[model samples]
Target chain A: MNTKIENKLTPVRIIAFIFVALWLVIAMFPFIWTLWGSFKVQADFFSKADWLNAIFGFHTEKQTGGFFTMDGYYGSWIEEEFWRAVINTSIVVFFTVLISLTFGTLGGYALARSTYRYAFWILMAGLIFRAMPHMTLISGYLQPFFAWNVWGILPTTIIVLVAINQPFTLWMLHSFFLNIPKDLDESAMCDGCNRFQAFRYVIIPIMWPGVITTGLFSFLLAYNDFTVTSMLLSDENETMIPAIASFLGTVQEEGKVMYAVAAVVSATAPLFFFVLFFQRQIVSGLTAGAVKG
Target chain B: MKHSTFLLFSLPSLSVMFLFIAIPIVSVFIQSLHIEHKQVIIVTENCDPFGCETTTAVDTEASAKLKEKAPLGKFNGFKTYSNRMHFAFDEVGEAWKSSDSFTVFTKKLYNYPLYRALSFTLTYTFVVTPFVLFLGFLVAVGVNNLPKMFKGPTIFASLLPMIVTPLVGSLILFWMVDGDGVIGATLQKIFNDNSLSLKASPVLTWIMLMVYGIWHLMPFSFIVFYAGLQTVPQETIEAATIDGASKFQRIRHVVIPHLMPLAIFITLILLMDNFRVFEPIIGFRAEAHATSISWLIWNHLRESAYPLYNAAGATSMVTIFGVAILLLPVLIRTWRDFKEKNKG
Candidate 1:
């Protein structure tokens, strides 16, 4: 009986394992392609021998130089334009999350705690904004959003992102705030802790998980958002998505055949890093529950 | 103890939000109506070698000029609308008999491209949204029911799709479905045929899109469904099991009912979004057979397609109205539900 059970279970396990392994490969194709292409030299970029020979499951020696190198990746790392975008993306993402989470949490708490007359209206308004089409908003403000400024167009872009993210963050944070029990607040109040103190001391500590959840979601939303950011930030020295897009545009304009490699590499770099950093949070977020709330 | 301090703490965030989002949204509505009225100035005597027609105001000086030379004209509000009418519609019955290159009604206010786009938008939204929710639910349920060790890792692994930028996602899909990519090459080799392009062929293009769309969106559904599952009352499940209900029965009857509200919520959001799909279409236009409503608007707005703009805008407006119409009932129900939750 035991042997029969073992034999049956083993095949199921193997099949499940293989299914997961294939999914991982499919999911990470962009990252894999980027890593491979980012390291190649200019000359070897179009070598049919490089891509074709590998396709046929055969190995061929390079004619002059090789397929992989540290040069391009390292070159891009030190490239002033790439670094400036890296700094710009990071700053915008960080501040947007910080500002949105602080307000979202407070506003969420107010809505969650209050049994007031207009609480439902407040929540509905938040939901409507959350569901509003981003294109509608951006199209309306295209010129003004990117108006050239002395401090550079970076601040305006960041503000645009913050607005885009706030509605969703508010909705997510409100659910988390409601999950934290009301008794904890009442007890803290009885103990002479004021509302702010209760929020800071009692409620926030328990709501840490919710805060982190909303914060990470906000970061990803801001980080990967392309159209709004692309339209809102026209300056070359501003951020990653538009910078890479313009690079692709210029490559096409120059009539270069080897531009595909750069396009693949620049696009997948952030995705690779995101997978590495927030793997845990992302997993939980995915499997947590439905969005009915 | 300190109500003033609480108010002060809340004010900053509210003001910032109002400044960035609320104010700008209102401004956009105002700016959409730019320069409602204008004047066209035509000079006959001083006309240079180059054709130069300037649009100024039809004021006192222009009125005197108009009396002297009737050729110098000024067109008004409905005049522009009338001029654009011929481009707006083709009356098929009359054109079929006349055969004069399909003379359209210049006085007509209808924008045909926008009309076509609205129907397409509704179709796209209605189709894509539900599938996303269903697939997401299945994946989430599958992941949740796994052994605890696999649960954590599987959830993280799925995030790969969500983490990648859609621009990059479109790029990767573009390559994979192209002639030289691994999947396409493998398909060609396996089938013993050379003519296999995953994205270029009309039938295959749709298959590629559906697959890519599912891959891009499944993770979002999985997360939300998973979170919803976490709230499932464990004791009730245990009671059902004790009463000899099959695992499938428990899920179908108890769990699905529990998840209904969430499914409805997700469906509304996804429906709104999928109807407005544009990014992937723009990225992979060479391969995609599908052209969404937003893409139609953008394509028309390009300088090459300049004459098509008013029609496209009209189409977009119609689409916006269509979505509102479809979602209006659900919006009302959700509002009532939210109010009841607060009340009860």
Candidate 2:
């Protein structure tokens, strides 16, 4: 991957550089603008009078007596109680990742090790399940949940998220298991260890790299979800994504759109940190499937 | 592994899928077949100074009792499926008979809810998947040529759109394109049309959503293709170069063939992912102009006057069918590959 081929192609290199720079701006500008504007008042953030007003914070300075204001944050966090949704999201994400990974690891290991046609069929089935639009599945869950009186709770939502997450988690971890040498586990069993014992003592030690990658995705699925959590969970048990959406309805009428902008930034902050720290793992996790194919 | 051992390992995962995913699908089909019961009616005659009058009234007690006994309501067979909302078979038939051209018929058909959703869903999936692939490859190749130190930051920036919550990502863009927002206000000043609003037109709404789709989805294909670029063998490129291949020739003859498998892989994932486009619709608040099938089902369940379970279930059934159809080609290819592996 050296520049031998590209050395003579100076014109192409220039074009490539410009295109990449333009793309970087396209990718970076929205988040940058939103993050900066989240601190401004609605009038300045929107800035219908003049677009430059947004950057200068003209309305914000006039309204709040400062260039920056905590009014939106205070209004959303204290007045609207968005902190409760943040706590709910934290609990849901933690358990969903833990349970999804636990199930995915065991099942993935079994699928990878098995030399049966059923194994192939199971993986194929998981593929179909993965493609099922999660909203369609929510329609199916609502009725029975209502009948059983489990319709609006965090635990029910957790179990459903895990079920929805299982297919993907299984496929990802299954591929990881296939990458681990089969002889590693067979040698452990040669020492008189049973199947579970080999997995416990041998496989578990080396499985973290793959497990952590898979867990990050499971964390994402649970964290980014709006379909299941919004519908199934009662307002008291709502997650951050849904909370922001719910904010839009009331805040719009009250002429407090800044509160929603603040809430959106608040909800997105964790994910920003997530991508920042786990960028490498996330990239590898995404490419793992493509590489295998 | 022993069969029992495999079963033990997989049982927890299998049972949850069976309980939640599998059973609900069956329940949805059953629910789709049945519609809720209408209130029972009673007729009574009242004798008064004005003379005997006949009156019909809702039999509340009997209707409540009926509702209690069979909570799913009356057995309507496939009636719910054919009604105006889910799939208007009769309307399609009428449009077919009356319209002189296919376009005219489709224009008439878009008036129906299900067909309108299907039209947008199919268009979005087909349009977005290919554009993302092309632009993604360009970006990947561009990023590949970037200085080493800049690559990481570039990838981090690119991952933001794909990694952020789809709802939140769309909202970020939606606000930018709002009439009062920066881009929106600038456009108004530039065009000198204060009456201009992106939300006011159906075509603009569609374009806005598809553009959002491309923005959100491009990074995925970019990352995957960028990774694939790393594996392009230098020897092959050198071989092509020695044989007098142009840069374009080198890419076409060497790089593309190497990345063909990945292109197919991306196309499959992107089609499935984009086909279920729901979040952006919510994020853009574009339901007035466009609705996806997934959004349609969600609308039935949550955004209606009341939760229309049967309607929602019917749409779910259709959507599941669509997923199966989309999946068939890949499944067949995999099955063939598996058989070939076993035979050899």
Candidate 3:
């Protein structure tokens, strides 16, 4: 690649390195700070007297008799019953991703294969749905959900997330499906298989790469969600994000802000490992739509 | 695939979408035209030692019975849309008649919740979109120049902000910017004003939220643009260099044009996302200073019983209309592109 030679300009190369290094600090310092502070007491982390107390754990040592402490984590996980929220989030994310991918692959396959103009209209409608704010959709569901007595539960939230996620999932998978040669499935259909057989046997196997990528995004949407789950789910069915929000409401009055801090860090740890393992797939998924166009 | 087969394949998704997405929009419209039911009142006569007294008491059972029968409340016929909380016809009319200067009138207009939220949403969308585009392009260019060994780690670190939950990410930064937190404390010492608070000042609050937005969003654009950069035609770059073009000139003339389509793609996404702008307001506790359309709907329904469903529905409908308008340009452009491709 000529990019190898393109950076030969010494001054420009140095400038670019400095700029990127500066950006690296801005992007990472908060995460590093939070992850470290989650172990310390509130006084050390939020020390007004001296900021360096956080690094040295001056107040933390005085209060907890150790340089590092797990009081925040213990408070969030045990005292606050955050494990219930974690279990809820796991159930929600697992089902939401499963259903979204199943629906997305099928619908996206149809959209990708069809030559009819109506397929274009379907995608256009999906585009509009994709752009509509999730809150607006939540407002729509509240009254009917209330009347139906399905307003707050894990299953209802999962299905709603699946439906809300469908448009974006459809769009992404449609692009990925387009790249998979149409010839592959058509030939399978010609040989002996019916359409469903051809899809199940031929397309499904090769589609895992795209499906996995799409599934990760679905996981992120379902996991990162606050608007839908917060409004829709009852307190007993609280997911991680909403649970962290509630912790802020109650814990602040009792001088237990560190519980919220620990909960946030706890929720973020899985996402960190997720990105580490699937960084390439995530990047590919983000660029898929752009590259197609 | 045959027509029957196509139907079988698309059936599950189509049905779920129609039931969940399509029906609810119609329901939101119906809900917007109605108000919550008033408590049923019944007059009862009670005998006391002195005299018989008449009292009107709320009939709780009858009200619950009425609500069960007609849960959407009483039909108000667009009164909610015109109320002070929403479009605010009477308030706007009063402001229109009372203010002398156009500036004062404009100031008075945003005092309404709808306009107040709209102003912040539009400003945030317009401001953050451009900054993200510029900074993303900068990072993409910068990262592209770095040594190969450093590239992977750089990208991994960059993805942290964007990949984390938006609410959690904002909370992380919000704690740090609290009056006694690290950045907040440092700034206080530097300015010699211990009383300084980022949350207290509306301007600083807006800037901080936008900064958080940019921090969370820039990575998406950066990664997209980074991918776009790899495809820039090296021959053209070499040709530009042979023609005595400087690095900046080469980038301006060559790299930018090559990535223009990706830029457009990023812009469409950025606009859609920035317009919502909900979580950070809640996460930063900045509702007093800023609100978006999404935040407005959330506010109305945030109460225990969602008694303000009419207000929430009206705002949701208006927001859906806003999204439609926002999407119009992209749709037209895509339609033209499709038509051109078909004609050929």
Candidate 4:
């Protein structure tokens, strides 16, 4: 028993534990620190006189008559009208996910079900297309959109985002549809149902898990995107990430660093909850490519 | 399904991909060869008793005709690719002849925008990829060994860094590394230097960016590797232990081989992802110190009064070229798989 216990407490195990603990701290400390700092006033948060005031909130309490205050969130959400950005982000994400999934599922089902040689080439093309930096395509969109007077609107950006998201969604959903045994839909077709009816009746029910997984990733892409939205959208149509970025750029001149911090935390909050709920799907989705490959 | 049915099924995605991906690729290449139309300025000299004045105005009709002829730009034939911002062959040759020492040659090389961005991009990609993989492997092994009760929360906590929006995650780190922020202040105190700032110097900025890259991506690598670990063969480990092998020896000889393929997959994904490093630079406001190729394109698009569409196109083509080269191994593997599938 003594030897077994000592073996379990080996030096390597101890070191591993220490390293993991340290990493956990490193990974979490910045977000926790910023979250704490968001509630403080500019003086306490950015206090040059003493850094401890940021943690202790001494000046914040003195100024706001409390240790924590909601002034930063108030300023960011209400006064700055960050709600406009929030609404725009929601609209973009909703439409992007909807359009991407609709096209992706159909295309993916075709790729998985077809016996044609073209399906392989199509997937290969998608893989290459997916590897291209999105900004490359955005450059091409700028001139045409400008000439057509269609640049800098939510709808154009949404469509562009959907286009950009197609490759990844198709790839993920293709592989996922592959995993569903063909017998399910084939048998349904054997029962005198047409191909569309088989797909609609048999495959759709079983494909929800895959669709949900792909949709979650699509939502993340559209929600987290900065490059496409920032370059494509006009100022009034700015999304949350781009708005936060603009805040960062102007914080010094505007003296609203706290607002930016609060905005960062707010933007992160939804994703935090998203991960909390969808941890299993995300983990499975991420590893799916590796496992299949 | 019939061929027509298959075609119909794929039509929506195919149309979108063709219009967006395929056409844009061709357009980027074509646009790189073209330049924005220049307005024709007509200058008229008016004689007066006080002085002779020259009034210059853009010839709107001529400009409009020129624009109608070629809306994108005139055909410049790769001028943007060869200019100071891109390949800079002439300047590089001049620098090579003028500089007597290697250090001076490098300093001059850094003056070129493409080289500057390439150096940072390459360094960030190579450095971040290995460190993230190693740390991820370590975390995976550690978590795999943890008590069953601790695993769920640990995994959840680890996922936060990755699952959070990249820009927001980087911002959270950026604020902490501010001079007055907690981490920055602590570093200053530890180093006993009052003026220490991570963002003030190029080297430190690159280091911070790399750290952020690792922090943001390690969780992804970890989760994938952890899942791989679950599938590791149990019998081999038991047999190695039965043969009186140490834990380290077993891991080295047995476990690593099992995890090698997963490691390669993670590396491929990481390489593709990190090669397009843009968000962290924006979030950290590190353009002053470092810029990647994607950032260079963004700067061209955003910073200029007239968006440098040609230059952006050229840089994007270069980025695409680089990504294609980097993706060669994956492409070869995919082709092999396809061939094998057809054979079987």
Best by lDDT: 2
Candidate 3 steric clashes: 0
Q: Stretches of candidate 2 above 4 Å error?
A: A1-9, B52-57
- Candidate 3, position B341, lDDT: 83
lDDT of 1 by residue, A199-285 (tens): 889887788787887788888877777666665664754566656555555654554423445544665666667767777776565
Tell me the whole-model lDDT of each prediction, alpha carbons only: 0.60, 0.92, 0.92, 0.90
- Model 1: lDDT of residue A139: 45
lDDT of 4 at A230: 93
Residue pairs whose backbone atoms clash in candidate 2: none
Model 3: per-residue Cα lDDT over A96-199, one tens digit each: 99999999999999989988887898899899888988998888888778778998899999999999999999999988899899999899988998888889
Ranking by DockQ: 2, 3, 4, 1
For model 2, how does the per-residue alpha-carbon lDDT over B44-85 read when each residue is reduced to its tens digit?
Answer: 999999899999999999999998999987888988889989
Q: What is the interface RMSD of candidate 3, in Å?
A: 1.1
Superposed Cα deviation of residue B247, candidate 1 (Å): 5.9
What digit string (tens of lDDT, one per residue) describes model 3 on residues B1-344? Answer: 56677777788888888888888888888889999999999999999899999999999999999998888899999899999888899999999899998999989987899999998999999999999999999999999888878789988999999999999999999999999899999999999998999999999999999999999999999999999999999899989999999989999999999999999999999999999999999899998999999999998988546458889899999988988888999999989988998899
Q: Write the per-residue lDDT of candidate 1 for residues B218-268, one digit (tens) a residue.
A: 677767787788888999998998999986799898899998888876777
On lDDT, the stronger of 1 and 2 is 2
Better of 1 and 3 by TM-score: 3
Question: Quality of candidate 2's docking, in CAPRI categories?
Answer: medium
lDDT of 2 by residue, A1-293 (tens): 45675455688889999999999999989999999999999999998888788888998899889999989999999899999999999999999999999999999999999999999999998999999999999998887788899988999999999999999999999999999999999999999999999999999999999999999999999999999999999999999999998888888899999899999999888888999999999999999999779
**Best of the two (1, 3) by lDDT:** 3
Fnat of candidates, each listed:
0.33, 0.76, 0.75, 0.64
In terms of docking quality, model 1 is: acceptable
Clashing residue pairs in candidate 4, if any? Answer: none
